[model samples]
Target: MAQLSWAAPSAQALLAASDAVRNPDQSFGLINNLIEYRDGKQIDSSTLAVYARADRKTGQFRNLIRFVAPQRDAGKLLLKNGNDLWFFDPSSKASVRITPQQRLLGQAANGDVMTVNLAGDYDASIGAEEEIQDGERQKRASYRLDLTAKNNEVTYHRIEYWLDRNNSRPIKAKFYSNSDRLLKTAYYRHFQTSLGQERPTETVIIDGLDPKWITVMRLSDWAYREVPESWFQRDYLPRFNPEQAQ
Candidate 1:
């Protein structure tokens, strides 16, 4: 039998191509328009801005965020330095340093229920193409995907992801706990290009167990600029950055 010279692109290849196509609109990355969370009987909403970079060698990430809400005068800042996490809330005028266990809880609250479900980690073979609504209008190609964490001990065991096929930006996601119970669902809305890449302008997280527990976040005025590395240090939260509060 003669070997076929051409085969359909691997799922990874197809996904990479999709990402490349959308990269121009998403080059500078994303600014979320909204993020909402509800836990039990409590509901909270915030406006958020996120920046992420993945380190190849360590397979880890540097994720940073500044979050604000109407009830508070100043927002909170969170930095995830690999496994360690640091947080500062201006309203309380306090900084909370998290241990690894606390970091896990924080990650869960932030919708990073599983390591694989974290944004910016891409795998092509897991999803199928579909059509989805873009913002309040416009229909676009999207990929509905299923992903499992490489490690099994995590709280969330499985995740269903919806990615904009044109840009490789995830539009929605559903997370499930180890017992196969629904934990939460996130919706990404209002995508726009900042710094040349397609990114979500808003994100909403709804707690499945408690409808009252919800969080809303919005991102605005996203700019690609260099921030000092020292900003991520726990020691820098209250002492080194007094000027930020002012």
Candidate 2:
């Protein structure tokens, strides 16, 4: 992966740069507040305490997402480690395998809540250079990154990612399915200092089928913590307690 210092930037390097801007390179935790909307009205909401740490071998993140809000949904966990995704319910003491494409919030998928290094999952190429409107409604010169999934396990089969040309900050992205249909349009906004660099603090997702159906994910309380690799194992779910364990 090439850094911004490269005069002749490679597609892979530029894509990696945008990924770095979105995800921290080390173990981190944050609070995600999700609000679902329907036709401009609030419908449902949830809060998640997310912990992510990079795997030593691949340097990809392994995430532990715990629901911490709305008494009814508390104590539920979603683990995304390597290629496996599992949902564990503390009340039932059951763990079930899940796909990343499963819907979590209104327009947000299970994969959206977890940390993923896109450069590791997709093959990228620069498609075009254009000035696009950002989440804040400001026009920005960006590089259109065309991404194709390296395998079937990824969230989307195709993605048209737009990143700021100057600093590689992700501006927005259009996701497409394998059948070449639009899935969702996501806008990364509200950049704030977290764990060091400025990262998107809010993500606004619009449903491809119904534009009125929206999901807004706001991130906060970001901190670097010592996340153990053992927490990612399937057998550890029943015993894993986010409050006392890690």
Off by over 4 Å in 1: 1-44, 47-56, 66-76, 88-108, 111-124, 131-141, 152-155, 210-214, 242-246
Q: Please list the C-alpha lDDT of all candidates, in the order they appear.
A: 0.53, 0.91
| Number of the top-ranking candidate, with TM-score as the measure | 2
lDDT per residue as tens, model 1, 214-245? 66555566665544567567766655443442
For residues 117-164, could you state the per-residue lDDT of candidate 2 as single tens digits? 999999998877778999999999888889999999999999999899
Residue 131 Cα positional deviation in candidate 2, in Å, after optimal superposition: 0.5
Can you give the TM-score per candidate against the true fold?
Answer: 0.64, 0.95
In every candidate, how many clashes are there? 32, 0
Which residue pairs in candidate 2 have backbone atoms (N, alpha carbon, C) closer than 3 angstroms, thus clashing? Answer: none
**Model 2, poorest ten-residue lDDT window?**
1-10
Number of clashes found in candidate 1: 32
Candidate 2 regions with alpha-carbon error over 4 angstroms: 1-8
Best lDDT among the predictions, by candidate number: 2
